[model samples]
Target: MSNITNQSLSEILESINSKKISSLELTQAYIKNIENAKKLNAFVTTTFDQALENAKKFDNKPNNDQLLSGIPLAVKDLFCTENVKTTAGSNILNNFVPSYESTVTKNLWNNGAFLLGKLNCDEFAMGSSNETSFFGNVINPVGDHLVPGGSSGGSSSALAADLTPATIGTDTGGSIRQPASFTGTVGLKPTYGLCSRWGIVAFASSLDQAGPMTKTVNDCSIMLEAMSGFDEKDSTSINKKKESYSKNLKDNIKGLKIGIPKEYRVDNMPKEIDELWEKGKKILKDLGAQLIDISLPHTKYALPTYYIVAPAEASSNLARYDGVRYGYRSQKGKDLIEMYENTRSEGFGDEVKRRILIGTYVLSSGYYDAYYLKAQKVRQLIKKDFDDSFTKVDAILTPSTPSSAFKIGEKTNDPVSMYLNDIFTVPVNLAGLPALSLPAGLDKQGYPLGLQLIGKALDEQKILNIGYAFEKNCGYKNEIKKWWS
Candidate 1:
């Protein structure tokens, strides 16, 4: 058989439905690719045996009508997969296996999608660089030492390396978009509540959202449609009919008003990012999009406010793993209190602990009103900024990250610098809007740089349309040489 691993998700699906390729053959190809690309370390656990069994069952009676029947993809370690090890890239949950599946993954399986395995991520999805992952940082396929972005680093890296045709990732303050930006992949963070969060390991309940990270824009739309829906089990899940985003994609942006937020022009941005932004603007303008300069004035405060709010929720949600429940526990503690403290202290990485401390401190009585409350107020202003801009423009455009992928360990010592990677992406999550990162151009070092499209709440179709137009006209490509093989 030909190298099916190099084909796009849509192509693979078409071939499968035509009976030209079986899911079992495609699954085996990906498994072989995963085994050969171990140097990237994109996966936390590889479910090769289970994936083959599932593929064999599907091949027996293929359902061509289903949305994702016989398709294989990887799930980020954050989502709970029944009977599969679902570690949120932390040693605390190294042995954790969910008896129940997360709503997002369950929906995919119901549509006949097979899981390749669990992808790596930052410890509890807290960091911008994948270096914080307890499973070890996922290496960028573009460069030997370059970081693949975080906390969805593994998801992005795997897709870029062709180890998986598509993958799912969570966006908690740019975990999905930033990594997609670095890896030159397409990642969508759907409107908050569009996808159910139940059974997913919580990092920040309010900000965390499950979305697809794929090689192409159409794949993202198809994956999003399959993964999203209402779930009574999750209070935050929106009760509405799922959208057919894939069917709605079109390569036309005639007369669409695209907003260019002035506040996104951060200080000391690299020339390549600025150029890529300009290139994107030119592409949209050429396609008949009316580019309007808009101001999201409160954007400056988004990162600071997000730091306070996300950590606060994370601290609360993570308190469940205090050694009394499932997950890691300290064997050296003599007392209950000591065991709780020791277990967390040893289990969590430095970045996760840092956020937890910041979270706990802000929520404490002495600082609750001063820090956490004020941050909440600022968050509203951030949302209001988007709300005001969207009224005038159909979509907003900006650089996904300040720069392209940097070498691993370059910013591990400086947390602030690492946090800056998500400066352009955090506001969208804070405002609970849908955003996508698509490959736009390559930096001077040949690393891929991405541009983002921000849309109104629950209006993913518009952004996907805009992205599809850009992808067709932009001529940007994401292929990389197989250095890890």
Candidate 2:
């Protein structure tokens, strides 16, 4: 493997800016790594030719002023790229191509980053593990048989494996943070509306937020700065002044208050995770931050509320892929009504169909008040829990996941068990807050464990700063051997 593949996104960009390495050299190195990492199944589509062309274009007329100058970033398949085959890791959209680019990717490109490829993800971003991806499960680079967490598993896996210098993923209830925890990488779920949803494949409209998955917190800040901004095209986008997250990043968190939520200590959580949490608290304390024991009373309701609210939005969002549009069609059906039924039945994977059914059920006439409406009420309570907590603290510290990465099929047979993996992460999404998962330590089995730093809405800068400081002191380095090749 080329040594260029080992450099962080910041390091590589610095080399590019100093003219020590051309953009073409950087892109080619990543392409070689991706080619050798096919066993990981991280990429659903590879656009090497276009990437090469773009790199050459950058080398010819380099723009050093751009934040992501000449960078090649692989993104979750959920983000639609102009004229690219964006499947969202589902057979339904296997042939779907978008004429326009997603606002997030457009932002990256505008800032001088070009597409390396589209990454595999859970079918319509539905499952907790990448096993539900129609393309194939993305294997964690940390271990051979371990499943990469999802629905942003491919983004996490590819990044951990160095298939891409940096990547982006959509978090709809722990998708980004859980996968990063599993892969021993950095992943951020930014505040809802911080990144636009326009042109991304929707799993759940209300909860889906695009954020960076990278090798380090600094790279995360750089990517986040480049990708986030207000988009008039997306009604949910926050129209705020563009913040310089990278420039503002500082390790001097002298008097900041970090909440150690008591509710995060769930029953049966592994001792290592608890130890990791303690380790994080100590790091913050040593860095001169105050740690407080806080209560998010509505934390337990987050999972059920997310399950109801997400699927309800999913069922409504996924209604467009009925074969009459630009995706997979069922030739088996003879008539229009039969076509819609057969198309959805044949097109969507098991997980996607399951969510669609669950969503449809909850949103149905008689059950709306009983399920969906009640979930919305509970969702507010969950948000209120965070809102109340933030009044007492600037940030919250918790374990990113209840456990480390599991074997590919360990939880596949039991969907409920798989869903439980996101227990520590789902609350952030339910509250629509920003959270960053940083690899803090290793478990007894040598798998990576993570600690989460969550901030108030649009307070991503604070958590990123805290994370940068924790990262400096944690002494956690991912020593993943390249066994995949």
Model 2: residues with Cα > 4 Å off, grouped in runs: none
| Per-model TM-score on C-alpha atoms | 0.99, 0.99
Q: What are the root-mean-square deviations of the candidates from the true structure over C-alphas?
A: 0.8, 1.0
Which regions of candidate 1 deviate over 4 angstroms? none
Give the distance in Å from residue 321's predicted Cα in candidate 2 to where it truly belongs: 1.0
lDDT of 1 at 329: 90
**Candidate 1, pairs of clashing residues:** none
Error of 2 at 397 (Å): 0.3
Give one digit per residue, the lDDT tens place, for model 2 in 1-485.
Answer: 34987889999989999999999999998999999999999999999999999999999999999999999989999999999999999998999889999999999999999999999999988888899988988889988899889989999999989889999999998999999999889999999999999999988888999999999999999999999999999999999999999999999999999999999999998889899889999999999999999999988889989889999999999999989868999998788999999999999988888889999999998999999999999989888989999999999999999999999889988888989988888989888899999999999999998999999999999999999999999998888899978
Cα-based lDDT at residue 199, candidate 1: 88
